[model samples]
Target: MDMDNFREMFLTEAAEHLQLMVDLLVQLDSDPQDQDGIDALFRGAHSIKGMAASMEYPETARLAHHLEDHLADCRQLGQISGVEIDWLLEAVDLLELLLGDIRNGRPERNVDSFIAGISKQPEAAVDCVAETKTVELTACGRGQLIQLQLQESVAIPGPRFLVLLKKLADLGTILESTPSTEDLLQGDAPNQLLVRL
Candidate 1:
């Protein structure tokens, strides 16, 4: 099932979504009534949570879920307080830390303590609209950047991979690319391929 591939993809997407959450939260704090910003926040959080859960990254999933519900409350109540924004921003930062732990093979890192603390509050438990949402963030999306540090042993030829980038490009637009294959093809990037798709 390519679990390692899934883990890598999930980590990459989660990191981007977490950053989006922070940016959207900051925007929401300033206006406090931007429905579009709120919706974006919900989408980013829900997307990351779903991906994390599928990859068995429960800690990341739970944090995303927590952030989703918190934002949902603001949507329903029509206002967001300074304290609420602070908590939301802080939660995303913690999510970033936990995501680093997960990518490092340390999934046992204790994060439930922080999650449980947030889960105890009533406002954080606001009910979300029931819908069968399936639009998940992929390894490519705006503001969802990834630093691909390929292993040294990976072969350096188009044949090294069985031609997958064509399929990826078919799914979405390649927004930006660096360390061109010309560089990697000629061994100029030293396998430290950096891309933002």
Candidate 2:
């Protein structure tokens, strides 16, 4: 198989492994002492790590490694907490985002915050969802008003909107935005976004 074929295979397998991890995490949440579930979770992360490394996706591999290491620690402890499971589930969400980036042939989203949060205690894991980005404001003046509408098939719109804003900010200053940057960071999924650039 060619590289594109390999990439397609990798994307399919990685998505399956991620879904399995989510299911396992849900099970673990109910029965934290389920040794079998813990082992499966660890294996899932390890599998993604190895596959991503082979595919030369460094960000995906690194994120998977962090998850694998965390699961290994949980295995050593012989039990996982609900808080830890919730954190892992969030990590899985981020992994899915990374997978989407890979599938789209786009650069990987920033994973540093997620990695840093995982490195800390479970209570701190939620910090990764809170981005520290600030919208740049320029002198008040008339600017090009651009409106964007995400496709109906888009599963997640908040991140895509933020990406659009970031790219627009690079081209020119943003005067205003519907839903606001704060709303987007807080997980608002508006179908349409208006920006004055």
Candidate 3:
């Protein structure tokens, strides 16, 4: 396949496999010793490996294969933990980096050093995209947003929130409040206080 066609194909497959792995990892986080979760992760890693290799990206394939191996070992040992999850996340990150290299016209890289550094760190804090976006103020969801920056120590945020809440209660019917009107009045929220009508 030509470079453009090959890249598109690889990206689609990689995204699918990555999503599968991410879902499995989230499940594993909830239940560390889930057999199915482990299997799912292994399958995802394996698929990524095959796809990468076929796309002529040896570095990507190798890294995925290594991750698959580690997961296989975990299966044999019958345990997986936070640290292992961290290691896997690091491996995934390395694979992403290699993929980026390939996409950018640079040669794909062997990220063994990046993989090795995971062990030294001990805990891998994976960066996950936010699950739900803060909804925009829709037609029915009309309410004033009270945002307060702590840079200026004007007054207690609670009092400020209460003043805002009172102002909001006057505008229209207060359909739903996130932290409850009472709680907000008690100075519970911070930085941003949103009221959705």
Which candidate has the highest TM-score of all? 2
Better by lDDT, candidate 3 or 1: 3
Q: Each model's TM-score? A: 0.57, 0.63, 0.58
For residue 2, model 1's alpha carbon misses the true position, in angstroms, by 2.1
Count of residue pairs whose backbone atoms collide, per candidate: 0, 0, 0
lDDT of 1 by residue, 63-167 (tens): 888888887887888777645665565566567677778778885356677678775543531111121112324654553343444333232222111122232
Cα RMSDs, all models? 16.8, 11.6, 13.6
- How does each model score on lDDT? 0.59, 0.78, 0.64
Candidate 3, residue 178: lDDT: 59
TM-score of model 1 vs. true structure: 0.57
| Candidate 3 overall lDDT versus native | 0.64
Better of 1 and 2 by lDDT: 2
Question: Model 2, residue 187: displacement in angstroms?
Answer: 21
Local accuracy of candidate 3 as per-residue lDDT tens digits, 1-197: 67799788887778777756755664575578899889889888999999988888888888888788888988887778865764565466566667668778899876777667644745423222112224556665465443323212222234334444554566777666656767854547464456664
Clashes of 2: 0
lDDT of 1 at 98: 74
